[model samples]
Target: MSKLERNEILLLFDVDGTLTFPRTVIKPEFEEFFYSKVQPRATIGIVGGSDLEKMFEQLNGKKILEKFDFIFPENGLVQIEAGKEVGKQSIQEHLGEKTLQRFINYVLKYLSELELPIKRGTFLEFRNGMMNICPIGRQCTREERNMFAEYDNQHGVRKAMINALTREFADVDLTYSIGGQISFDVFPHGWDKTYCLRHIEKFHNFEEIHFFGDKTEPGGNDYEIFVDPRTIEHKVETPDDTRRILTELLGL
Candidate 1:
């Protein structure tokens, strides 16, 4: 692993399985610990496969938002920079509403046409516009969830069907990033999870940005970032292991 000076480090954590354990249960326990570690941090953010509204809804305490400077929600397609939402006047400089609306509408229409049952976990997974098309289209049962796990083992990476979907919608300027389970992301050419880190780096001036994810293989999203040390990184495994690594490498 690479090292960072503690004083200069900016902690950006991916939610879901990384920061929170019991990955399926987005509950109070995880939020409680999240608040405990994050409240005092000056520079931090939450980068997850969720929209801003969904992220806020899942938040366990007010303190989580009170402390973090940004929420790179919807992948890198949206950003809540320095405590400001993506739209509104102040934060409008980096992203545009027209583009977002087009993308959002396209997705909405696309999914509506499919007319799948939309439920918790059954909806799209996105952050900063890093979008994931869940196989079941929403939340599912234990048995149904296995399909995604199976998908990864058999058809994941850049060549998977999800990747083909991006190609199918090639007009949208999309790309694929294999995420957890059967989830796969569709976002702009340079704006995947790794790009979110790089975008943050460009704006914030970081020496390096370290990433972590449960998925990494031939077509894994973080694979490219993991190989590069200058702007991005991809850690393979649980958040606790990630924490252990940061503790030793950066003396955090």
Candidate 2:
């Protein structure tokens, strides 16, 4: 397809579990297929909860900026278009230091008191747009991450923590989202994946916006954009699922 023809549609994807496995690099075969076949048919973009650096580690490193037409890291709090950063937002700027500290302190206390199967360091990760709170810590090994995912599924640890946070910070205009296998994100209202649409709309008009993500259930980080009226949503379970849908939809 010609560039003009392809630009009429946007294929927006979530990083983890959509384009690649959770917190892992994209497979070489899939990467080659995506760049060689899939990317040629439409305008490609990525909206991920992780910071740009992490997105880089998983999706072709610094070259990612050149790969995707739109790169929305930190849920578009940090926006890059055509290899140039166009916009950025900061959680510290949105929520004053006093409130931010209070929230952090409260989360630390809650995590400290709560009992988990195991605990490691870096429980509270402050990002450009939000704070990622991991009860088992982000430094856990791959096996441990999978273990906690199973444990949280059966025990509802992350859900319960989100519930507690929702009640405690009810008046703070915040949104707590559960994503990936390990942690939930805390950000101001409207900072979810849908935030990227604002930037996309400002620059181009597309006939269709198709979003593919795994965590589209309620309170999942992808929920807002998945259900948003503007885009057609595809709920995928794995990178293979995403590739299948893309091939079927675009006839690749």
Candidate 3:
């Protein structure tokens, strides 16, 4: 297809599990295939819950901005197009200091009281549009992360925490989403992955918008956009699944 023809269809992907293993850099071979084979077929973009710096570290460092047509970091609260930031939002500004402090204090107290298989530091991470809450902590090693994932799968630890948060902050307009293996995110009601759709719509009238993500189930980070009417959702279990689906769907 010609460049213009290809640009008419936008292929949006999630970063962590959809494009790369969580908290790791992209594989060299997959990166080659994605840029050479996949990029030639459609206008590609990435919408990740991570901040831009983390996305860059996992995707391809700072050069990632130039490689993708659109980059929606922090669930599109920070929008970058053509390697330039076009829009941005702040959660601290939206939720006043009093409310933010109350939420933070409650979370810290909850974490301190809860027991886990193992715990580490940096349990709560503040971001541009959300806070990432980690039960075992984000500083865990890869083996620790995988172990926690397995344990949480059986115990539903993250789910339980999210439920508690929902109940405690019932009056607050906050959304809790489980993403990756270790943590969940807390943001304003509409600041999920679907938030990127608005920014994408402003740029072009694409014939189709395809979103590929691993965490597409209810309460997962990808749930909103995956189920949205504006997107053709492909739920993948890993980066390899994402590649296979892309090749089969687009004939790449």
Best by TM-score: 2
Angstrom error at residue 212, model 1 = 3.1
Q: Could you give candidate 1's per-residue lDDT for residues 1-252 as a string of tens digits?
A: 344443345666666556654235445554554455433432566776556665665564444556677677655456677677653111123345665566556655654554322323555654434556665554676566665466546644324455446555666565676655656666666665565665665667765455655554555555554464553454646656655654565434
Q: Which scores greater on TM-score, model 1 or model 2? A: 2
Task: For residue 56, give model 3's deviation from the true position in Å.
Answer: 1.4
What value of lDDT does candidate 3 attain over all alpha carbons?
A: 0.91
Structural RMSD, model 3: 1.7
lDDT of all predictions, in order shown? Answer: 0.55, 0.92, 0.91
lDDT, model 2: 0.92
Please name the candidate that would achieve the greatest lDDT relative to the true structure: 2
In terms of lDDT, the poorest run of 10 residues in model 1 is: 86-95
- Name the runs in model 1 displaced over 4 angstroms: 1-7, 21-42, 57-62, 86-131, 151-160, 166-172, 197-202, 232-234, 250-252
Residue 138 Cα positional deviation in candidate 1, in Å, after optimal superposition: 1.1
Q: For model 3, how does the per-residue alpha-carbon lDDT over 39-88 read when each residue is reduced to its tens digit?
A: 88888999999888898789878888788999999999999999999999
lDDT for position 75 in model 2: 87
Ranking by TM-score: 2, 3, 1
TM-scores vs. true structure, each candidate = 0.65, 0.97, 0.96
